[model samples]
Target: MTADDFRLILFTLGVSAAAIVLSLPFGLALGWLLARKQWPGKAFVETLVMLPLVVPPVVTGLVLLKLFGKKGPFGALLERSGIEIIFTWKAVVLALAIMAFPLLLRCIRTAFEEVPRHLEEAASTLGKTPWQVFSRVSVPLARRGIAAGLVLGFARALGEFGATMMVAGLIPGVTETIPLAIYRSFHAGDDDRVWMLAGVSAVIAFIALWIAGRLTKGRHPF
Candidate 1:
């Protein structure tokens, strides 16, 4: 691999990791809420959460662009604060996180739901507070699922392309990730480089799935 290829690989890995880290807390909270709570508009909220999964990547990217572009409300506010997101690595991270969020949440919510309710009730009866029960009993039981969700999220982030391209603009050594670099190489007729990058992506994805499988082994009922 060339120096540029190495750089792109690192950038992609960094962005994917950042996206997962940033989304982790929010995914956990939403997953738990969806698993355990019943409320008005719950279905509506779920549909909204799952929207990105179904939407075209370009469409998602466009929406993000409108919301985070320089003239957009959020973008303007951030600009006033001296933080720019559009056409930057931050945009790439945001795009990946948004795209991967629903998958992560679904896995985590399923995990939470699979936890035995009686265990939580038993803990409650034993004078354990809700928070204590959740922290000690529920989370531990669902940890495997959470790990699966995280791996899935990371893999999704690593492969992100359309939305990231729209927001981050494929800036070399800045926002160019493995997928983007591969796309550039293919279009530029760099067939060898394209194959190499594709191979790298495949290997990374396989490693992530292998780790996830190990984490979830014997835990899932299936």
Candidate 2:
């Protein structure tokens, strides 16, 4: 592989990792709350979380662009701190996080909901703090599920393209990721490059799925 190809692969990996790291905690927290608590406007929150799954990726990207572009509220605030997300690797992370968060949340919420409430009550009776029970009992029991969610999120991030391209653009060596690289090569008629990158992505995605399955012990039922 050429240096460009290697660099592109590395960029994809880095962005996917960043996306997973950013999305995991938020997804888990939201999912746990949704599972454990009853609150007003819960439906609205759930719909928002699931938006990426249902909305066209291009639309999602466009929304992100508007919200994060220069002169946009959040973008302007971030710009004051010398941080720019639009058309940057950070944009890729944002797109991937948005796209993958729902999947992670679903997995985590399911895991959390499946926990036995009696165990929590028993822990409370034994004088364990709420945070202690959550940290020790609930989390440990759900560790495998959370790991599976992470792997799935990573894989989803790896394959993300539409939203990423719209927000991050295909700036080679700067924000170019594997899927974006494949799209560029294909559109440029560089069939060899396209095939090579596509193969790499497929392999990586397969490996991610394999790891996720092993972590979940095939509990996802395909």
Candidate 3:
């Protein structure tokens, strides 16, 4: 209702969108690989990918903070380039991407696994390269499921709180998101603001789930 509330909503939406865009390429590649191949370390890789979902969000955030803090190797390198992530808006995106990755990957992998290998083979027989078969036949058939995965991922990003708090401190107009705003509002005894923000988040999440369900046609990813 207030300008600040609207700003938080917009900020959260922007960060969630950025998180989805950042993670999608990696998700697509890993999903296709996991669905189509069985390498020696596949199990290990799968477990690693799912670790964030099972672990405490704070733990994930701590690890990320350590890795991206000023003294950390990556952070130091970035600092030299005049870039910063720790306790900044970028950290919010980082947290959301990491937290949402597993769900996105699961949906995408399942969709890719369901794609008929015979169809790919048929394309190959027609002199289509692997990329062509993937980009054309395989992707087209799996489009609906991929879209579902994206919606789920976006929803997950929107709800992220713990890990985000760890890496991106609640700095209004900078790093604060919907969940963070709710936390601050509740603690400050601003019941009205909290209720409004909660309603907005619930409505957004419901719409996302509805769209995902329709896209997947009530598939497992929902």
Candidate 4:
């Protein structure tokens, strides 16, 4: 690859990493809620968590746009605070995080559910606080699941296109993630760059999947 291609790849990597960093904690928290809690509208909340997985990407982008665009509610708030999300790298991160949340939550919920309740009870009886039990016992036992969730989230972030494009606007060196760049290039008839980017994205996704698989091996009881 040329230096320019390498630069583009780096941009994508940076944006994807930023997105994953932003998404992980929230995803874990949401997943824990889904797995450990039962309340009114819990099923609705679970469905909401998975909404991004089923919604059309363009529609997702439109929803975000309406909520966060320059004249939108949050957009006005951020504008008042002198912070902007539209047409920026932060916007890309936001879009990616939204799209990746479902995968991360799914992985983490599975991990949380796999933790035996008896163990938690045992820890509680030993005077360990609930937070301590969660931090020391539950989370430790579910590290592999968390890792898998992270990888899946990262992969989803990496492949995010429509939402990123709509939010970030395909500005090169500013908001053009690899997936968005590929779409732009293809539309502009830049076959070489399009193919190269497609291959690069595929390779990156495959690597993430491979890492997830290796981490999951022998970790699940089944």
Candidate 5:
């Protein structure tokens, strides 16, 4: 309703979108590899991928902070390059993307697993290269699940709070997202603003889930 509220909504949307875009390619590649390939340390790799899901959000944020803080290795490298990540919107994107990754990877992996191998083999016999078969056949067959994963990732990113707060620090009109705004409004005793932001968050989450459900309908049991 207010300019600040509008800004918060926009920031949340931007961060969520950035998170999805950042994670999708990696999720798809890793999911496909996990689904279709067998290799050493596969279980270890999977457990590592799912670590963020099991760890406390604050812990995840702290790890990120230590890795990207000014004195840390990556942070120092970036600083030397004149790139700052700490306490920025980029940090918000990183936090959300990390938190949303496991969900997206799991969904996409399941979708890839559900694609019949025989279809790929048939395409291969018809002179289709592996890449061609995957692009034309496997991907299309698994599109519903991929779309669902994308929607779920976006919803998760939109609602992310703990890690984002730890990294971005709730700077209004800079890195403040919907959840951060709600926290600020509630703490500031702005009950009307809190309720408004909460309602908007809930509505956005509901719409995302509904779209995911529709996209995955009759496609996979997941």
Candidate 6:
């Protein structure tokens, strides 16, 4: 592979990994909440959380752009701090995180829900606090599902193109990931490069899906 292609692969891997790491904590919390809690606005909240899966990726990216553009509230504050996010590598990470969040949350929530509540009750009876039971009993039992979720989320993020393109602008060396690279090479009539990149992406995606399947096979989410 060419140096540029290698750079794209490395950059894509780095940014996608970063996105997953950044999202994992919040995903865990939200997953637990959705799986275990019952509140007045719960249905609305679930719909909101799931909106991204149904919404157009470009629209999601546009919303992010408006929220983080230089003149926008969060963007302006960051701008004063001299940290640019729009169309940067950071944008790529952010797009990946957002785009992949729904799948991650769904898998995590299913994992948590699959944990028998009776086990948590048993832990509580042993004088465990809710948090303690969650940490010691629930999380351990749900590890496989969590792993599956992470793998699936990574795959989704790796394949992300629309939202990422909208937010990150597909800069050649800076933000071009595997999907973007494939698109670019195809347009440039570099068929050989396209095949190489496409093959690389397919292999990675296949591995990810295989692992996720192994982790969650025969486990149906409610």
Model 3: CA > 4 A from native: 218-222
Please, what is the whole-model Cα lDDT of each candidate in the order they appear?
Answer: 0.92, 0.88, 0.93, 0.86, 0.91, 0.90
> For every model shown, what is its TM-score relative to the native structure?
0.95, 0.95, 0.96, 0.95, 0.95, 0.95
lDDT of 4 by residue, 27-85 (tens): 76777777788889989988987999999887788888888987999999999999999
lDDT of 3 by residue, 1-222 (tens): 999888899999999999999999999899999999989999999999999999999999999999999999899999999999999999999999999999999989989988888889999999999899989987888888889889999999999999999999899889999999999999999999999999999999999999998998854331
TM-score, prediction 2: 0.95
Tens digits of per-residue lDDT, candidate 2, 3-67, equal 98898898889889899899877877788889889999999999998999989999999999999
Over 1-222, each residue of candidate 5 has an lDDT whose tens digit, in order, gives 988778779878988999999999899889999999999999999999899888889888998999999998999999999999989989999999999999899889999999989889999999999889888988889999998999999999999989998888989888899988888889999999999999999999999999998987798543
- In candidate 1, list every pair of residues with a backbone clash: none
Of the pair 1 and 4, which is ahead by lDDT?
Answer: 1
Off by over 4 Å in 1: 220-222
Give me the displacement of residue 46 in model 1, in angstroms. Answer: 0.9
* Top candidate (lDDT): 3
In terms of TM-score, which candidate is strongest?
3
Error of 3 at 154 (Å): 0.5
Candidate 1, residues 104-218, lDDT tens digits: the string is: 9998998999999999999999999999998999899999999999999999999989999999998888889998888998999999999999999999999999998887778
* Number of colliding residue pairs in each model: 0, 0, 0, 0, 0, 0
Question: In order, what is each prediction's RMSD in angstroms?
Answer: 1.6, 2.2, 2.2, 1.4, 1.7, 1.9
Off by over 4 Å in 6: 218-222
User: Model 5: runs farther than 4 Å from truth?
Assistant: 220-222
